[model samples]
Target: MDYMTLKEASEKWGISSRQVNYYCVEGRIPGAVKIAGVWLIPKDAEKPIDGRRKNIL
Candidate 1:
């Protein structure tokens, strides 16, 4: 499965890295995996809130 790093996901979503981290901490985004002290977001995972396939900017 393809995954995007926190930086990559933040860039794609037009959000700051801090905001992404907050979401991860709050469990607002799904399919986030933490490995080796890094967060990975699945490329095909749906956006947490609305079950949408696309990320909100």
Candidate 2:
């Protein structure tokens, strides 16, 4: 399977790296693993829905 870095995921998801990290920490991102202080997200992983958003599908 292919993997993408936090920065790449952030850019792809149109969010901040910090938010990606937070998602990883919260287990919001499926198949996201942390190695050597770096986050590796699956290339095909879908962006998790934001709880802060109202009625966002």
- lDDT by residue (tens digit), candidate 2, 1-57: 899999999999999999999999999999999899889999999999988879848
Model 2 C-alpha lDDT versus the unseen true structure: 0.94
The whole-model lDDT of each prediction reads 0.76, 0.94
TM accuracy, model 1: 0.71
Give the candidate number with the greatest TM-score.
2
Strongest candidate by lDDT? 2
| Tens digit per residue, CA lDDT, model 1, 1-57 | 899887887888877888777777777778788888888888875544534356759
Candidate 2 residue pairs that clash: none
Task: Kindly provide the TM-score of model 2 when superposed on the true structure, using C-alpha atoms.
Answer: 0.91
